[model samples]
Target: MGRSPCCEKDGLKKGPWMPEEDQKLLAYIEQHGHGCWRSLPAKAGLQRCRKSCCLRDRQVKNSLAS
Candidate 1:
């Protein structure tokens, strides 16, 4: 498959997310639940794709266990 675009420029708030960013994303999902990833980036103020976000969460979980 072809490479995808960088996780920025598309209006995503690139770089690392602050604690508030993480809280907001988690809170939104906890209250309302997940929606389409294509729309979630903008809605959640995240510059990452749904796929990237999913991967990041997975990595975080994995790291915590070790």
Candidate 2:
């Protein structure tokens, strides 16, 4: 079976996120316990997919570890 694409790649920006973006995402998740990832971009005001956010964090952590 094929997997569904995560977020809408319309006008959303994708790349290495800035500190402000990271702060906003962290604050949003802290305030709102991560409900629907599909709708998270709108709610959290982020241009990234929920999966991308998670992957970014993991990548950062892994890089730091090594």
Candidate 3:
């Protein structure tokens, strides 16, 4: 079976995330934990896909590890 789309393509933000966007995502996950990737973006008020959030989270972790 084909994979389901991570998010709706229309009107969604693409490319690098702004610092504010990263902050919002980080704050939301800190408060609520990583409940659900698919829904977290909407809950966090981000116009990004769940995959983007996951990737961003990983990037943040990697940066901190360095």
Candidate 4:
């Protein structure tokens, strides 16, 4: 299998996530859950890609649940 197209830079945001991005993602997941990771970024209005969002979810989710 090959890497996802979403993984490419594609001019998407990179580096550390801003507070607003984390808030938006958390809020969206709280309201609707992360049904489709591939489309979650756009729906949540985040500049990150799917993988970034996935990683963010893990980071935030783990920290919160711990």
Candidate 1 structure quality by residue, lDDT tens digits, 1-66? 887665644665566657776666676666766767667656777767676665655555587689
Estimate the Cα RMSD of every predicted model relative to the unseen true structure: 3.2, 3.4, 2.0, 2.2
What lDDT would candidate 2 get against the real structure?
Answer: 0.74
Q: Which residue pairs collide, candidate 4?
A: none
Tens-place lDDT per residue, model 4, 15-43, is 89899999999999999987999889999
On TM-score, the stronger of 1 and 3 is: 3
Q: What TM-score quantifies how close candidate 4 is to the native fold?
A: 0.83
Ranking by lDDT: 3, 4, 2, 1
- TM per prediction: 0.57, 0.66, 0.86, 0.83
List ranges where model 3 is wrong by over 4 Å: 1-8
Residue pairs whose backbone atoms clash in candidate 1? none
Clashes of each: 0, 0, 0, 0
Candidate achieving higher lDDT, 1 or 2: 2
Among these predicted structures, which one has the highest TM-score? 3
Model 2: residue 53 alpha-carbon error in angstroms: 2.2
Shift in Å, residue 33, candidate 3: 0.3
32 Cα displacement, candidate 4 (Å): 0.8
Output the number of the lDDT-best candidate. 3
Segments in model 4 whose C-alpha atoms lie over 4 Å from true places: 1-6
Better of 2 and 4 by lDDT: 4
lDDT of 1: 0.65
Residue 49, candidate 1: alpha-carbon lDDT: 69
